[model samples]
Target: MTRITVLGGTGYAGRNIVRVAAERGHTVTAYSRNEPASPVEGVEYRTGDVQDPEVIRAAVTGTDVVVSAVSPRGELEGTGKLRGIERRVAEEAARAGVRFGVVGGAGSLFVSEGGPRVADTPEFPDAIKPEAAELAAVLEDLQSSAAELDWFYVSPAGGFGEWAPGEATGTYRTGGDVLLVDESGESQISGADFADAVVSEIEHSEHRRERFTVAY
Candidate 1:
């Protein structure tokens, strides 16, 4: 079984991933600012700030994979904190020769020819823009970094997260940068299904060193 450390394990997406990973019999260490209110069984919970590399490194030690689900709230100024944290995690994962996976935003995903990113679209909420931009920047940096890190940036389907909770059908579609939509022209997936995609990636090496998205 793979030993996985999930940063931001208490958040919505992170918690789902942790639960699914644990259920799959993978050992999980859930690192967050606070313990989960209802911690998943079989998960080892640890409390710490996401920006601390030493803490992250300690948590990552001996782990087979590092899944960064850390969310950068928009109120936080600049991308320094988020970038620093991701860079450090990538660096440490490289040093430890471990695989890395990131929960990236759909902001960087293209919608159409010459159209703006999902985050830049008028339909996208303004409240999430800052965090989306920060995530995009971090992905860009990770792509350009010198470290030979085998990192996968997993972007959710459009209308993802708590705001758009699609029903879990135990089946979903995966795509690269292009958006995936159902026959109804809707792009979404349940939290559990998204977690399923992440765990599938963990088990299989598809989308290595690149980004992929999930949808109904």
Candidate 2:
């Protein structure tokens, strides 16, 4: 079984990844600022700050993959904080010889021809812009990193998250950067289905050294 460390493991996306990974029998260690109110069985929960490189390194020790699911909120300060955290995670993962994967924002995903990002669309909420920008910066850093450090940034479709929980058919479409929309013209997937795709990537290594998006 693959040993995995999930940074920001208590967040919406992180919890799903942790749950799915544990259900699949992979040893999962969840690193977050606070422990989960109800921790899932078969997953180890550790409380620590992601900004600390040494702490992050300790959490990732003996793990094959590190999934970053942290969402940094607010304005410029928040963006700087997230950048620091991402850099620390990448540096520590490289030092520990572990593969890194990130749950990136849909803001970086391409829309129509010569159009704006999904986050830039009118439908995208203004409140989440800062967090999306932070994720985009982290993705850019990962993409420009050296080849020896294997990293993948996975971005979900436009209508991701709790509000738009699409039915899980145990299947979804995957694409690189471009947004994936179903035949009905909806771009969304359930948390479970997104988790399924994340776990699949962890096991199969299909999209490596790049970013990918999922939808149903």
Candidate 3:
């Protein structure tokens, strides 16, 4: 079983990933600013401020894979806090020879081949632009990272979030830089299924040092 650690283990995406990884028999560690309200069994829970370099180093010290499910919102919104944390994690993971994975926003994905990004669309909300931009910057940092750094960034569908938590279907479609959408033109994926796809990648090691999207 792989030893996996999630940096924002209490958040929506992180919690689902922690649950799925533990259920799959991996030794999982959930690290966040606060302990989870409902902790998962067989998983270690760690509470610490990710702003501390030591905390980031500790999180990546021994894990085979380190995933950052942190979002650029709240105190982190527009502050580049999440981006710095991701960079630190990436550096630590690289030094320790651990695979790095980031759960990014859909705003960075291209709407079509050789076209505008989702964040550039007029329909995208102005309020969320800051958060999206920060995430997009995180992706850019990963892309320019050293070749030895094994990393992957995942952008979920446009409709993803706690506001509309979809159910798990044990199925999902994956794509490259372009965003994936359903036949109805709806871009969405269940939180559980998205977590499944992340763990599946962790197990299979596909899409290395690149970005991928998930949808129904």
Give each model's whole-structure lDDT: 0.86, 0.85, 0.93
lDDT of 3 by residue, 36-112 (tens): 89999999999998889999999998899999998877766666788898999999999999999999999999999
Q: The CA-based lDDT of model 2 is what?
A: 0.85
Candidate 2 wrong stretches, greater than 4 Å: 74-77
Cα error, residue 207 of model 2, in Å, equals 0.9
Number of the candidate with higher TM-score, 1 or 2 = 1
User: Model 1: runs farther than 4 Å from truth?
Assistant: 74-77, 113-115
By TM-score, the best candidate is 3
Tell me the TM-score of model 2: 0.93
lDDT of 2 by residue, 1-216 (tens): 999999878887898899999999999999988889879998999998766767877876889999988877522246578877788878878877899999988888878656788888888888888888888889889888877888889998878786765666788889987888878878887888998999999999998899999888
**Tens digit of per-residue lDDT, candidate 1, span 56-126:** 78977989999999877743347567877888899898888889999988888878657678888888888
* TM-score between candidate 1 and the true structure: 0.93
List runs of model 3 lying over 4 Å from the truth.
none
Worst 10 residues of 3 by lDDT: 71-80
Worst 10 residues of 2 by lDDT: 71-80
Q: Name the top lDDT candidate.
A: 3
Clashes of each: 0, 0, 0
The total number of steric clashes, by the backbone 3 Å criterion, in model 2 comes to 0
